[model samples]
Target: MVQSIVEELEPLFNPKSVAVVGATTNWNKWGYSTFTSALNGFRGPVYPINNKESEILGHKAFARVTDIPDAVDLAIIVIPSTGVAAVMEDCVAKGVKAAVIISAGFAEIGKEGKRLQDEVLSIARKGNIRFIGPNCMGFWSASSDLRGFMFPLPVKDGPLAFVSQGGNVGGAVVTSGFMRGVGFHRYVSCGCAADIQIEDYIEYFGEDPEVKVILAYIEGLVDGRRFLDKVKKVTPTKPVIVLKPGKTDAAAKAITSHSGALAGSDEAYEAAFKSIGVTRVESPEELLDVAIGFLTQPLPEGRNVAILTPGGSYGILCAEACATEGLEVVKLPDRVIAALDKVFPPRWSHGNPIDPAGDRNLLTYLTAPGKLLKVDEIDSLIFMGFSGFSIYTSLFVSRESGEGAPWISSREAFREVAKEFTRAVSLKDTVKIGQTILPIVSGMASRMGIYHEEDVSELTEIIAAAIVSGRLRVPFLVSAFLPPGSEALAEMGVKTPPTANEASAHFLVAMAEQWVASYKKPVLTTTFFTVDQPRLEGTHYAYPSGRHAARVLIKMVEYKEYLDVSQK
Candidate 1:
């Protein structure tokens, strides 16, 4: 039944002719953007309906929906909330099958508003009219170029499918996606959701062949059972990332009042997410980061991570994070260690968190990463260093004070060495390598005598460039949750902390490690930050944060051991 609905909605997005009710000549009104953008973005025929205006945006206007010369497949209603019922009636009379109502001030307002909402739905039902929203901001359909609302910015077509309960959040997600090199296949802003709900969009995105990853920003779940059912069906084939807000009592109250929604117990929501295999996210950034990872990197089989860094401190922090996430930081074998030793200074660490040190030239960088890539023991590699190494040749040279200006000569020598090193590290590897390029100028300037200000700035810019180029070559997985049964692995010696942020990072690494171990595939990794900690009100209650961690851990377990094969 659900599958049939998804198929029906697909064409609405790719309609042949669209009628815009309440079309206005005034550019200040939403009618202008909605109508104009649709005409520009969508290549289909557009009919503008407005009794007051002869034309809108240079297109002849019809007096009413029924007056349109031909049968329209879709209708976009941007009229006032009070007038929507009448417009819908016209749509029914004209035999418009699908509609997107971008009007607000309905169920989200109050009981009176809800009555008005029900009136609109009643009209649609009687006419058998399927609509998207009464309070939604609008939606963008890449395949059909169906732009139905006044989105502030232009959106490029891509594979990511995004749905959000909050219109503002949806817009923000679309905007952020543009900056991060992410693209979208479709975007639906299900505002009050008086008609078509969140689950409907979820089901649609799940079944969308062109959409490889689905992202949602939800404040409340209207139907838990149905949502879970769809999640169970969708997650194995594609990655679904959800960012849900309003966990705190005060915040939850505000959200409920704002949307006129009954945000169920956060604990119940968390349990539902886990039982169905949904990846719960802490922030908007985390949602995007994790989605990017799922879109780019392969699902990891197990939770064993190998840390590779340019500095000892960074390595230590990564190791601590791995331990907290229950990932095993196994020691390198003698053969692996011997290979690294040949390229590293005596002062460099010989353990699992391999640090080649500051003085190590470009040859050592290439050699160390190559050695790690060949070792079967390491599941994935995390490279941490300043962005300076990526761009400036001078940043790699050691300072030399001499009348002969030996530093200049040294810099040239290092450039040759660095080029060779960059090429080696950037080359494809059987094991996944994820690199973190820190802003070096700021760090160096903060250190009293480590580097001069000019040198620091130059190094920072250089490393930034290198980091950008490296990212282009190596696909990175954002943070992901570990599957269940990770608890058993935890019992096997993996340790995780109680904090959600730390737990999320740890679980991500563990999942990456587990992936390499189980599937013999390389996985790249990254992290997202969060400060949220929701409380559990009862024994049966679950903290949203903890539940999120559990979901990630369970995913890892499933990926590694095939514990939950039904999802696959």
Candidate 2:
């Protein structure tokens, strides 16, 4: 039964033809925004209905829904709340099956408004029509190019699915998501849920093949038991993330008045969420963080983490967060420490966090990552670094350096000397010795994309490590530390500028940890502090130099998740 409903809802987004019952020419009105968004986003035929206007946005406007010349699969109602019933009736007369009501001032207003909402539902029921909302923002379906709301923003098509109780909230989620690399398959804004409730959308997305992560910005749940049942069926197959507002009594009262909702007890909702395996996040940012993590990384088998940082402070913070989140920060075995000692200087911290203190040059930056990744005690690694020397070094060596140079030769010499020393020592477990050095060597070779004398040696070490680590199965999260008053850092380069709050190094770490907890995957983030001037329009926003580390981390995790899941 649930599967059939999911299948049925697919067409609501992928309709062949749509009718805009209250379409208008004024750009400020909801009718105009809905019509324009549909024309811009939907690939299907659109009919605009406006009694007073002959045409809107160059499309011929009909006087009523029944006057449309072609068959209409979807009807968008942008009229006043009091007029929704009549518009819905006209839709039924025109043989429209689905309706999206983008009007406000319905049940959310008061009892008088509730009476009008009840009438609208009655009319839709009598006509056997399924409607989305009476006080909502509408929805968007990337697959179908169906955007039925007033948000005049652009979005990409991907696996994330979002559902929100407020139209503005949905718009914010979509906007923020697009700014990041994450995209969406569908978005739903079911205000008041008078006709179709939140559970309906959850059930629909739960069975959707295109949607891997389901996110909800929820204020209240109408039917707790049914919602939990749906979540139980969905979560094992896909991740369900919820960002519920109304935590305080004041907030709950505000929510109830705003949406005409019965904001339930905050504790009760929290308990229900935990009982159903639904991951609860605190803010909109956390919701997106977890959604991105689930969409990008594989779930770790256990809560044991291997922390890696370019500095000691970040390592300590990572350790604290891991413990607080009920995850064990395992100690690196002596053998692993001994192997690290071969590459790092005497002052390096060879403990679990693996902090190579002092200025980390490009060579150390690149080499340390692979070493931490190869360790057996560490199931996963989190790389934390700051701007200035470390970010420049890592990016330069890993991305910009066209030819393998000084460090490449040094790595080869070290490997050959280590191999001879192991043989001289008659170490039976030279397998571990070879395993530790190989990945570092090969990673450098791969980065250079050429086979030189150094390349052969480095590749050899990496291959040996791969064999020992069972193909080096490790998930890594990267973070970049930023200095205080770092708002100027956002304008340093030709990319998306980071917000002041987003540029904070501590916020980045918190965001990554929240991602791990919410989605059970490793996350990477970076920060920067700069004094560069802001770019004007037509010029791209300048993202700080260190921010690229976070971007790379996000991309790597996403690719890994795609390969793992797709192979399965």
- lDDT, model 1, position 502: 34
Q: Specify the highest-TM-score model's number.
A: 2
Cα-based lDDT for every prediction: 0.62, 0.64
Task: Give a tens-digit lDDT track for model 1, residues 369-479.
Answer: 445655667655554441213322222211131111121134454345334434545563212121222222343234323333433433333333333333222111110
RMSD of 2: 11.2
Clashes of each: 31, 9
Candidate 2 wrong stretches, greater than 4 Å? 1-3, 369-376, 386-525, 528-568
Best by lDDT: 2
* Alpha-carbon lDDT of model 2: 0.64
Q: How much does candidate 1 score in TM-score?
A: 0.72
